[model samples]
Target: MHDQPPIPGRRGFIRQVAGTALLGTGLAACTSTASHGDNNDNTGPLRFAHGVASGDPLTDRIILWTRVTPGQDNGGGDIAVRWQLATDAAMRSVVASGTLTTSAHQDYTVKVDAAGLLPGHVYHYQFETGVAKSPVGRTKTLPRMDVRQVKLAVFSCSNYPFGFFNVYADAALQGDLDAALHLGDYIYEYESTGYGAEQGKQLDRVSEPRDVLLRLEDYRRRYAQYRSDPDLQAVHAAMPFIAVWDDHEIADDTWRDGSLDHKTSAYGPFKLRKLAAATAYHEWMPIRTPDPAAIDRIYRSFDFGSIVSLHMLDTRVIGRDQQLMMSSYFDANKQFDEARYRSDLYSPRRQMMGAEQMAWLDRQVEQSTARWQMLGQQVLMARMEYPKAVVLGECSSTAYVAAKRRAALDPASVTDQERRWLASPSLPCYLDSWDGYQSERERLFAIMERHRKNMVVLAGDTHNAWASDLFDANGRQVGVEFATPGVTSPGMEGGQPQRNPDDVAAMMTDMIAPLYYAQTSKRGYLVVTATHEQVRCDFRFVDTVQQHQYTAAVERSLRTLAGPGNRKLEECPPV
Candidate 1:
């Protein structure tokens, strides 16, 4: 069983702090100077190290979170912390105030639901223990009515060792955002010598613990190390977050039963490790648990008045079955087993979001009266079909690009082999995404088409920016997807180092029917702005993450109109 902290009941507004009501008149930008209490004097035993954050914001309630570090003199026992919510940056016009206790069981992390707040209003919050005070955090409640527009900053795949979180820093400066959506891989479980170790060595941002995270303490330490970064702290302080876990939060390519990265004989039972990871995630993250008994059941929905209904889905840990590997479809004669591959690819038993969650999603969409139904989830949901020759490694991206150019310039210059390769059947490139579970994807599309509602999907985990039109098996467009690039993780450029990244992106867009835009090289996030008429997505890319100082620019802006039979992406000028 998972060890969880006691959840406090929602309390009414208490008496305001004296002599600070005037602070609400003039508000400033939300920024945090707290860095693991490094800049503060060591006078008190308790200190706010990880800074303050708020998440899971509702119209009248929001989850406020912070961690307190106890000094050696203060024995490892429970410590009382006080939190206050106000209508000002200085936290002077205090609205709600409460006290909570934290112990080592929860890694000294405190989470409280600040209730009794006005809807569609920006609020400031802070945590205090003795003389130590956490940096003030700014948060907004979800709009209840009269909603015109809602803007969100979407991000994912932030590998600390890869580089600086310049994307987060840039997004933090955007004061107009309503909230931030983190589509997981929030923290990696790799050891210091694993994955991005070489980059860490060069950038001096190595992973903590120096070993793979298998226990609760390891995950806790890793979360602390990530929270200490100034860029991440600033973003958290700037606005509330709605987050869900992806594979790297526990292990790579994780499914319902096990993960490809884990070995049962060497790592022991995968369940115990998963529990530890989940427990640490709940303790550290600001998200509220829909079911305290079930830590993995994070599929939930948020309503932004009558304008947008955001349904965050758990497509990673809860219901995903083992991914289909291409290696299993090869025969001893070195020929591909097309018959068996097709049979298993369309297996009805294969599940992506599981039956229970799928049913719940159906109910949510059916009941929602909002103009836009947005699905915020992990992994690509669109069909990323590639030529069979490319899937089988018979033709490299460079070779395909060269062949296409030659064929375009002079038809007689194209070889017969090149022609055959170009005419090969198209197949799903990544089996781990919705492409692997075709039946389930069709079921979801059917649900959207049945409802006849405007749909938009926000996706991540590819570490690359993409915009694709979502279509069903019957060739009917159901919705559109806007996938954000990684905050720091490398994309396709990292894999195809020899080929030009522009060529790879151009070839992908040219070949893929649904793909409208593709940025295979860059680290950044996506700003999605939704109005009543249309939803626009601005793909912002940072020039580099290798250094603390960098420049950011909007690479592309795409939008889709609202209404039935209009679910297609069109390029828009960058804002």
Candidate 2:
């Protein structure tokens, strides 16, 4: 949804080299001896790791991908890359095989769409760059229409700068995922130490970007830095990923109007940086170009037959306003002076999916024939109540007075109660979520109401897992939300206040019953399994994120679709 840059002569070379080196696919020598260097050789010695992967599961076949290492700089010669897909890992019977050429043009990443595969079958796939043998990868096509179960590991917000991808490693070891959905923030936009926190150990690698992303090369390099991460590579090789992005893929808190990272406050003139980020995102990610007709673009539907139909929505770009950086209480201090801090969270025109995406979502939901409709997206859907106890200048007359009871938190967090009662504007200040788009959130809930069908929303990017029973305008139950935590990035309430997961969970439960379960400071992903009767989200957590080796535990949540408006959801200890 952004204008492409004019192809200058030099820019042509940059785009030309995108194939192999840009994506870190083609390597001639080795990632081991060379230590994941920039050796993009087009010919000879093409070696690579992270094996072949497939995604966007269709009935018959899936897309296969791999990166080959060529020699020391050509990004791999114009060598031909061949792939084989067999029902057996050892290639007992050749199911689908093909040969594709790789060059420095594509950064040596070979992605082939293997057809003629039997649906719902496990297939072993492998890639070969000349004489160099690549690793064997396991992939599966989406089940046929009659299948009953689809289990997936859904994740997002993996910052290489944070730590090793232990979460990815864990999921890979789980050895049981139909498809893995990586919901954006696959890479971060920061250099070392630029983003607030740092992992226990130094991040294995730095951004291919030495600085913030402003131009095309900078953005491309950013991906390079992240892809160089071995654990990330392993995960990519391990399974197929259906992905979407949130802000920080470009810059933090971006919208139609500029970004939170901008220094000038005078960028409205050219909109150069914003456009660049969008262009790079399209070129780098496997996502289709934002189709404007679909509303602010990026609202598309994926049919998983009669059981589940996934509508993945793009939250950034389009109609969203520049994110509100501070709460009204916090804003009050800045509103008196800083023009930028003063923002309208309730601005009627600002949107989450924009008018275009909104309308598209409406149609997708209405026409869907699937028994379950899942919206795979970014951001939270249920209304989040911060510690703010004030409404404008007055106090809340509602019975939410008990809501002010702040958690005996890590003693580090400013609870909503502490803020509202203490009038500490900084306590529980949360303007960064869907609360910033009240009107749009309301509109979407209304759509679910009209469809007379049950809905389930899956989300990530928050860095903390949450299970909530969604309610409509009338405060009646409508749907449910399963918000996955981060892969490596830490959440708002990590062990900072250092309370037990269950104790903190109890505080959260006391704060909001609809918000059934939450784990503030854990690292891992969510494994969601859906059947005709119920959609169960297993919020899987790793014991520790700071270490390289960690195990996962799950907090299970369930939602039953009795009818359209009769959806019911609950979070309970895993059975």
Candidate 3:
């Protein structure tokens, strides 16, 4: 029998963190500082670090973050920023106070997690530099498990060029989110003129660098360009973000060793591009990634007081193959021969969370004691429909037939689900999702069954809104999925998601009973709140996304209680 790789627990991670410079970049450098041209903030400079922000939202307290740049250089600089959290709107009655030191290393980003406070509490905060102060901000703590109400603004697939982030801007004004979970594809790495799927649309935001990102410089430029968006800036300024990424952060539909658009030979190579994207992500986002040796450590858990536990899944980088199509062929037992399953989907070594990470995740979900355990992820978890006959049998027929034959003869795809397309729902083809990894899907299902816990998956991607009932292998209802529309990214509804929108949501609601709710061509986010008894999701839509504003229209509402893990459309349990 072949021995599987041993799964390392949290302690193993700590050891790995202490022992190696995971990414091969020395630890000294991970925390090192580069010299900036000059020191400009003698008076508390309002502009500290890249910007004032926080992430990893939890029940008791949220992580308060800020960085002070020395000048033009981002690598090195130091300053002190005072942060305070309060319970009232007036900023009186300070609850948490701290002094944070900014250093040249870690890009001068100062992160201090404030803990030990009330659950389900909404707090106002402010950051103070010598004389400059950040705008007053508001955040809501997660509820304890016994608490019966909560709300979350779930979002994903935000591409700046598609349009303005009216979704986020509007989310900020609505003011009822316990926290906003950004499920990834936060930014795209395409050139200024647009590349790949974003190529044809008229761009809404332009980046500083106008090329595909393959090097560290390219990645950094991409992030900086994204940060420069005023609407994006306003969203960040308004509330703390809980975020992760999908393929666009690096390349489209990326797996561990390859991507849909970038072949190993095409962008120099996978390792180089991966490193570049990873480095830039660490330098830019308010999230965390483990050191290279500790690459298995990224999947983490956050307790929203006692009521819910938020699991942020790292599906893109750690281990995942570029998603595959079901159009090809498989064997008698619904298995695609890993060897014969050609294309990026059939590589025997292709992994979604990698073996170790998956095992770790299994443990996290199993050990959770919270009432509602939610996976704040980057893409669709429930199965989506694609008309295999039209997409595979007809649309790209000749080429598809040739590729299918080539993969069948390949030795790597034995038992792969190459032919599952025949059974999958007929719809338009979306090549960048879970439909590509059926085996991985089964493995995850087994884990969920073992735990027998109530699970709700919240996501963004597809740039649309959907509410789905999750099914197990036996087709038994297992969980619920609420996908919030994009903050500003374009949807299948063209650039005008709100246009002729009268029938799309209804059409979707009619087609998929399990997936009973939806809204498209609508810009905005969902406000999610989970309680011991139920999870509430509010689809907040904005009237316009072309400019900066906080105004939002509450287009719809949906809720799912803990009866049998299926979602039911109704008002969320009130806090």
Candidate 4:
């Protein structure tokens, strides 16, 4: 198991007093400050070290978050904090105010749901204690009705060690967004030399833990490190966020009970590691939960009035079964084999969102009165099957050969459904996505059809931009999906080495049943603008994540009408 760095002890009384005094004085003297929206108030650090954030907006309320880093005076103990919500940038017209306490037990983080605010109107919020003050954060409540437009800045998979979070900074400065939707991998849990260590070495942005996270403290330290990033802080401070965790928030390729990254032999029980990871997530993120004990209940819905309803899901840790390895179906001769497609792989019991959550989703869809139903979840729901040439090309790689060697030794372990796709132009089910649980995807499709849901899916985890027409196996259109590119993490080109990324993307679009557009080489975030007339999706891309600064350009812009009718995507010229 990985070890955590020791926490510093409390400072001396005199030193603490001096430090606090200097901090307060310096913050007052500073010219670069956070104002209501107009004034430039001193914004650096006085009390809040991680800055202020807001999330999980509703028609009447919004959750505000901040971390109070206490010094020797408080002995890192609980401190009474005051929070205020106002409608003006100057914070003179206060609408709501409250007092709360936060301590090390909850990681000194403060999260207060400011209720009674009008929907679709912008609000400014801040936290204060003694002479210390937090940077004001801007947030907006969800619209209940008469919502003309809502712009969401979508992001995912921000590996700190990989590169700069230029996408986050860009989105923060854009200022036109109503909210931000983070589709997981907000932080990667790997050692300095693991995952993107090579890039980290080049960028001088290494993981602070310096070891792979396993224990509770390890996870906490990792989140602390990620929150320390200025760009991430800026984005959080800029707008309200709706987030869901993918595998990296816990471990790589995480399922309901286990993960590929877990090693019971070295890391002990998988449950404990999962607990630690989930605990840290709850502590650090600004999300609200009905049952704090039920870490799996991250699946929930947000209604944006009569315009749209966003359903966020816990696809990684909720009810997902272990993934089926494709190499298991390959024969010893390195050729595709059809005999291994097992029946259990298609078993109705196998689920992406467990039975309970599935039922909940169905009810949410049925109950929604919104014009558009948006599924916000991790992993691509669109089908991606490989051609025989692509499969052979991928299989011929050294990595695939090694994987095949491992699978051949455990042929009995291969799932039947996976084996079904092992033949000519096999569908190499991306074990981590909806493709791996065909029955569940089908069931979800049926549920949506039953509800007559006019839907569009917003997905991440692919680290690539995609415009796909989602359909049932029988070739009936269900919805259109827009999979956003990464905030910093690599994409398909960065993962598969056998074929050129552009060539592979072209082949995928040409071969896949409903795929319309695929750009797997760029690194950036997405901007989704929603209105009653249409939902506009802008696949924004940056020149590079490797650099400290880069320009953002829209790689593609598409839209779909909002109605009970067809949800097919139509390409629109860039704005």
Best by lDDT: 1
Candidate ranking under TM-score, highest first, comes to 1, 4, 2, 3
lDDT of 1 by residue, 135-222 (tens): 9999999998699999999999998899888888888989899999999999999999998999988887888879999999989888
The worst-scoring run of ten residues by lDDT in candidate 4 lies at: 16-25
Residues 1-575 of candidate 2 have per-residue lDDT tens digits of 21121122111211211110001111122121113333332354457743455666677767777766666544435878788888787877887788888765655566676788777788888887657777777777776578787788899888766666777777776677787887777877765547633442353445555566676666666665556556666666677777777777767666676666666544333266656665555444444344523323555667766788888888776667665544323343523222333345555676877887888889999998887888888777766553233322233312223334422434445555445454423221244467667677888888878887778888876776777888764777878888887887767453224434455455455545477666666676888888887787766666665555455555344555547545777533345
Per-candidate TM-score against the hidden true structure: 0.91, 0.79, 0.73, 0.85
Q: What is the lDDT of residue 184 in candidate 3?
A: 80
> Candidate 3: which stretches are off by over 4 Å?
1-46, 59-61, 72-77, 80-104, 115-124, 140-146, 195-204, 263-266, 288-297, 325-350, 392-431, 495-514, 548-551, 565-575
Question: Candidate 4: lDDT over CA atoms?
Answer: 0.75
Q: In order, how many clashes per candidate?
A: 0, 31, 53, 13
lDDT of 3 by residue, 207-263 (tens): 546677788777766665566554555566566677777778888767777776685
Candidate ordering by lDDT (highest first): 1, 4, 2, 3
Off by over 4 Å in 2: 1-44, 73-77, 196-205, 264-298, 325-344, 390-429, 494-503, 571-575
Report lDDT per candidate: 0.83, 0.63, 0.60, 0.75
Instruction: Evaluate residue 539 in candidate 4 and report its C-alpha lDDT on the 0 to 100 scale.
Output: 77
Worst 10 residues of 3 by lDDT: 17-26
Residues 1-575 of candidate 4 have per-residue lDDT tens digits of: 21111111111100111100000011111111211111111243337777889999988999999888666677656799999999987889999999999887887878898888887889999999989988888888888787787788888888888788878877887778988999999988888888788998887777868899998888877887777777788889889999999999988889988887789999899998988888888888989875886875798899887888899988889899988766666678866564455465677878888999999999999999888889899988888654443344533222332333445678776555334333335453465778778899999899888988788899988666788888887888888899887788776563345545555555455456577877777777779988888888977776667766566676577888865565888877544
Best by TM-score: 1
* Winner on TM-score (2 vs 4): 4
